[model samples]
Target: MVIPWLSVLWAAPIIGAGVVMLMPRRALAKWVALAVSLLALGVTVVIAAGFDPGGEQYQFVESRRWIPSFGTGYILGVDGIALALIVLTAVLVPLLIVAGWNDADNAAQRRSVHTYLALTLAVEGMVFMSLIALDILLFYVFFEAMLIPMYFLIGGFGADRVASSKAAVKFLLYNLFGGLIMLAAVIGLYVTTAGSDAFGSGTFDFRAIVAAVAAGDFAVNPAVLNLMFAGFMFAFAVKAPLWPLHRWLPDAAVEATPASAVLMMAVMDKVGTFGMLRYCLQLFPDAATLFRPLIITLAVVGIIYGAVVAIGQTDVMRLIAYTSISHFGFIILGIFVMTTQGQSGSTLYMVNHGISTAALFLIAGFLVSRRGSRLIAAYGGVQKVAPVLAGTFLVAGLATLSLPGLAPFISEFLVLIGTFTRYPVLAVLAATALVLSAIYVLWLYQRIMTGPVREGNERLRDLVPRELAVVTPLIVLLLVLGIYPKPALDVIDPAVGHTLTTIDQPDPAPTLADGNAP
Candidate 1:
């Protein structure tokens, strides 16, 4: 039998966290955490090596009973999307640890670094589990459980601990409320599935759930399905922090450390969109179709609103937060468009965004650390003083703006092209944000990095080895993906096709000039 790669991918960090808690020397915990995260990355590489890019089925699947009475089991698997996300989670956690090497100011606080590392590891483990989980109950369990570590990560460590605590509380409350609503949906789905021929027997296996929904085996009411889909969609929306429901993100991201923000924004938030693709579109195709127009409207609104708001922000971190809101809008739009290019573009966007956003946060955090400020006004002529740092920022910023020859551009272009074929007006409206993105990013760079040296800003340091170490990989990835995306897309397309097939949707063919096949 093949090794249980998914279990190993998740368990390494939890085991590492346990070992970290036992470490006699507190300083060693970060190293241990880093080693564990790297190990997880290595395992993911092995999984990828063995992964069949052509296969649409979940790979490395392993299932065992968790609660017989509830028909719940510890089911785990990954498609290309899940594998890519698992890799992202693994890649980011170690960088997060490194970024926080000296986060605590006092000896007392320093002693608790182990706790911080342990909590981070816990989050990594849980996130991996959430990505790979094939049981609805197990998915929900990991989904909700990962938030605890994040709450502490935000609250316990940051530039403003007290304010961070408040943000954490807000984040927790929002997610928990959403999760509870999802729980009701899960129960509702379970009840609808009982005695259904589609599942063979009552089970919380996600595949079975999908099969039941697809076959119309469950005699669920349309109204009930709509309500359940809304619940699931809302929970994910809150997590995506999509407009209106997105209020928690700026607060949490602004208050949290750069590392925390990386996890929160770059890694964790993708779970929300991933759920929309995985469960909502695939399992609740009717509801997804029913709600497409509404979701598309919200996504377009978020794109323009986030870009406009970002242009007005003074705080660097908060501006990035708002920009994420805009980027997420694109991802959402791409997903709801339901075209092959749109789906593939959205999936690719998730990975590309994570890498580019990490470079922004980490480099920005490094700048903030040296200058002791996050306000754009406080920084001036930084490029003159630290050209390398300025260059890094420029590359990352260009990626954010979806400049050609960078990763986001390809994905963004694909999204718009695919969307235009089916959603012409929406595509045009959403494309306006591209100009807005350029304004905010270039304007921010000009204000912070290009002006005459501000008082007390003349002596700012360039990117240190540690900071470079943290950011280099992400930068390399952005360029590599921009230049050559086919490897990733090869893995992603089959899964995208599977999802579209499950939803019984096909890409809309382009109309010929003569209204005939060319």
Candidate 2:
């Protein structure tokens, strides 16, 4: 019998968490967590090896009824997009454990090491489940379940314990509010499926909803359908933390440790974009069409707004948080533009952004740990004292600005080219934000890493062996993907093609005459 790899992948981390909790040695928990996370990563590698690249259908599926009355079940599967994200999740969690190991050992955090490691493991499991879940109810369950661990990760262990607590509460409240709105939409979908001739009975499976909606079996009122779309979209928007809905992020990133910040910005935020693609566009094509202009306007506004605001920020972590807001704008624009290049670029951006941002946060953490500060202006002449650290920061900063031959540059270029095909004005406006992004990144790097050596910074140490281990993988990945992104694009394109099929949208072809003239 074939192993249920998706189920096993999700369960491995949780089981490891339990093992860590049961161990008598508290100091050993970090090693245990690292071991567990690596094991999960190994499982993901095996799954990827076995994954079918040519098919659009869900692979490695496992389904069993959980709540029959509502047609809810423990259904799990992955298409190429889901598989790519699963690999990303697997890669980051182990690195998180490694990068945060010192923080976990500090006197301020020594007592809670087990809890911190366990929560990290559990969050990995929850994110994996959310990515693979086929049932809407199951997805929601894992979606909300992941937050509890992260809430504690922020409040109980990070810098400024009291402020961190407030940020955690704010984060929780915002997400819960969004989740509740989505919960209502999920129920509405359930009811529609129950009454549909195509279903004849209720179903919470995402596939069933997509099929029934495509066949017009729901016969839903246009107004009601719009409302349902609004519910899911708003929930995802809040998570995407789109402009104006993004107030919680700067606060959370400012107060949390760099390790926690990486998880939040790099891994967690993708859920919002993932939901927008998997549910919003696929399940509600009409609503997506109706709302496309409004969303594109918001995205363009966010790209400019985030970059402009980031220029004025003094806090290093908070500035990075704002940069993500701009990056997410690109991701969202790619999805809503309803073109294959756009969708694939947006999906690929999620993975590339995660790598680049995590490198930034981890390297930032090392510098902050040495200097005991996160203020961009607090130190100067870092390169004179810590050249290795300065160099790593330069690569990460260059990646953030989407410098050519880096991973982000490729993703950003695709998004612009795709968006330009249909929304040229918005694309041009978004392109201008690339300049603003460059300003913030280069300016920040200049203030922190150049000039004559500051008195205190003269003694600053470069990245130690462990710190090098934490960031080197990310830098290597940036170079690898920058030069040749075909492997990832291959996995992503088929899934994107399937998504466009569900929405009944096709890529707009450009005329040869227009191309030549341009």
Candidate 3:
């Protein structure tokens, strides 16, 4: 009998969250949470090991009727695109639990440690469900639901309670507004399908809709389709926090605890870009192609805007938040470019950015915890007192700037190359962020980690064993994926080819001196 791998992968965390909440001791809760996350990771690894890159587009699929009357169902599956993110989510949650081990204990308005850990696992489960849900309605339900736990994680536990609360509200308001629009879009899609003879009673199954669309059976008015597409795209763009819609990210990321912030940015946020790839492009190919130019333009603007803003930030955590905006810009750019390399790089970027940002932000959080400040001028020579911490911080910082031989470097290279092929001028414009990123990262490092040891910084302790355990794996993954990204690329490439094929996009052929396509 075939095992329900997708069900097992998603259910483990949610069940573990319940078990964690029942634990009597804080230490027990922490260990149990870590063990549960590790279990999820193990399950993910087994699934990955069993996954055939060149096999069916979505492997380990499970489907069952949920509401036959409304045409919705319980459906789960994993393509390579989704699988890569599943690995990222699974790997990061365990470390995040480890990193935030004491975050709740020290919060000004303290909550139970079990509550915090349970919420983290809850978020993990919801993210897992969102990534694998093959039914559009199922995906949307969890997509909106994950925000509740995240809202509390931000508002209830942070260094500054008031700021964290405000940030949480802003985060909620922005995403909820986007989700509300997406709800209308979801209904619109269902209504459209219900009317079409192709689907009979209508269905929310993603594969079914894509097949109908591919067969030209999804005969809907262009104007209505564009409107529905806008509804969905608006929500995703807001979630992806692209440019103008990105105002909530910096505030939320800065105010939340480092681990919660990483969960939000590194893992949760990828759902937005992932939706753009799976739903927007496949469900409404014409609409996606129609708005491609506008999306690409916004992406380039975000790349430059985020980097430029980051350079001027006085707070360390806020600076890192802005850098994510810049990095996300690249991911969105790659997705909209409609090239194999671009999409693959975008997919890989989601994972690499998670590792790199987790390392940088968590390390910065540790330093802030030590010094009790997030200011740039708070320290002058951290390396003198805590050489190991300083060294790790430097490596993470370099990775953030996409230094060569680091994980992010290859991802960024492919994005630029992919974009340049289709949109040269915009690619050139986006490349300027490389210099901008270098300035901010190097300058931030120079100010915090180097020079003479500051008066207070001299007493700062290096990373403890727990912190080392958290930081070491992330750093090693950055190095390993950096030096050899082939393993990941192998899984990602075939999925990308499928997406490009579905969208009717082919990689551009190079031309010779005679102007003939090669």
Candidate 4:
């Protein structure tokens, strides 16, 4: 029965993709994606309802043979962490589709509706499966599979198809090259464990490797593990678009439709962070320890740099893209801090970011739809015309800036608390970025949503019923989760605790910029 349920979770979105592709009307395509997202989300909730948080091993797990000779099988399971992301994916997919309901205003744009819809569904399915994969090879497969749909999303459904395609290719190349390196590393890992296979064959089973490491059946030298870790981290770094590698993100986000931007920046982008959680910690604990300082440094730099750049951006979408970089910085810092609080915060940050970032991107889409521009200066005093739209924008803007009652505030606060215990100076520096975030987010809000009414701005209309329907749930979730994050944090804490325990490392104590470890 669980197998049946897992199969539905995997297949439902794909089926929706097919349905959308088959439908003649763009309207039907939109609804098809929405229905599929809701259906998959429904299945996910049911899985959570049945999931016992106390279960040590993965529940609702299903494993069946796909390649008998190769010792490869289709194995899937959900612990609390994967399930949380699955739920986030389910929530955002529909929001993206609904947010972009009017994105394609012309014939050329209309033609892309089905393809974009289908690709989004496919990406959702792939990402969900990737998070649950027990086998390393399977995880890698699904991980790379996500790039396909996202490539189409950014490339095909973008604001300028040519620019989008170029960015897509850039995105694809950066990811694929990283994947190839990881494949070599995966193969190396498989070969190293080839002799221990009970099936008289090598495998890419993640759990098996963890067991092997624990049992001392094989020992990985720190150096070799470091190499593989580099390959894996390279892939995830590009995906996370960490600081220096983040150039591609702003370009792609600016070029993308709000739906594409939301899923890309919020959903698909989380894949990078997820990979760090699952792969870096699971596969390369020693390397993680070895590289923690460097990665943490990158994370802090991204936090400050991203915030500073966001302040300078005059384009709405570009500013949001930069905010993601800053948010990711905090998330990465928390994860690498390797403290219970840090890991928990990082996990919570992922879920909260999904809600908040997706909402911001969706709001930006509506603004563009009305104003026909992505420039921040394009309109003024829009509150005079569209109070509802302006109000929603305020919520989203405040949420992005991590205002105290919003979902991100709690998560970001936890990250700071956790990171400070291990990296005080860095945490303080990263904390400074928050003040800057307030500056950009509030100033951007004031400039775009308030102040003097422009000469032609009086015609702007408030959020309509359908648009309100899409935004209302996200806003409510934002407030509810903000005030009471225990429900999400409960599931998150255990997984993060387990992850840190598996690695068996305490966070390093905070110290000065010099080598002194106080």
RMSD, every candidate, angstroms: 1.6, 1.7, 0.9, 2.7
lDDT of 1: 0.88
The top-ranked prediction according to lDDT is: 3
The whole-model lDDT of each prediction reads: 0.88, 0.88, 0.95, 0.84
> How would you encode candidate 2's per-residue C-alpha lDDT over 1-518 as one tens digit per residue?
88888888999998998899887877688888999999999999998998888964798889997999989999989998888788888899888888988666662535478888898899888889989999999998888888898888877777677898999999989989998999999889888878777886989989988887777766878788888899999888988878778988888877777888788888887888999999998789999999999998999999999999999999887898899999999999999998988989998899999999999988988898899988888989999999999999999999999999999998899999989989999999999988999999999999999999887797999999988998999999999999999999999999999999888898886757556522
Give lDDT tens digits, candidate 4, residues 195-304.
55432578776777776665556576678889988988888888887888888888888777778778887788788898898888877888888999999999999999
Off by over 4 Å in 4: 1-3, 105-109, 195-200, 507-518
The residue-by-residue lDDT of candidate 3 on 287-362, one tens digit each, is 9999999999999999999999999999999999999999999999999999998999999999999999999999
- Over 397-474, each residue of candidate 1 has an lDDT whose tens digit, in order, gives 999999998899989998998899888999999999989999999999999999799998989999888888888888
Give candidate 2's whole-model lDDT: 0.88
- Ordered from best to worst TM-score, the candidate numbers read 3, 2, 1, 4
Q: Candidate 3, clashing residue pairs?
A: none
Best by TM-score: 3
RMSD of 2: 1.7
For every model shown, what is its TM-score relative to the native structure? 0.97, 0.98, 0.99, 0.95
Model 4 accuracy (lDDT, Cα):
0.84
Tell me the lDDT of model 3 at 476: 99
Ranking by lDDT: 3, 2, 1, 4
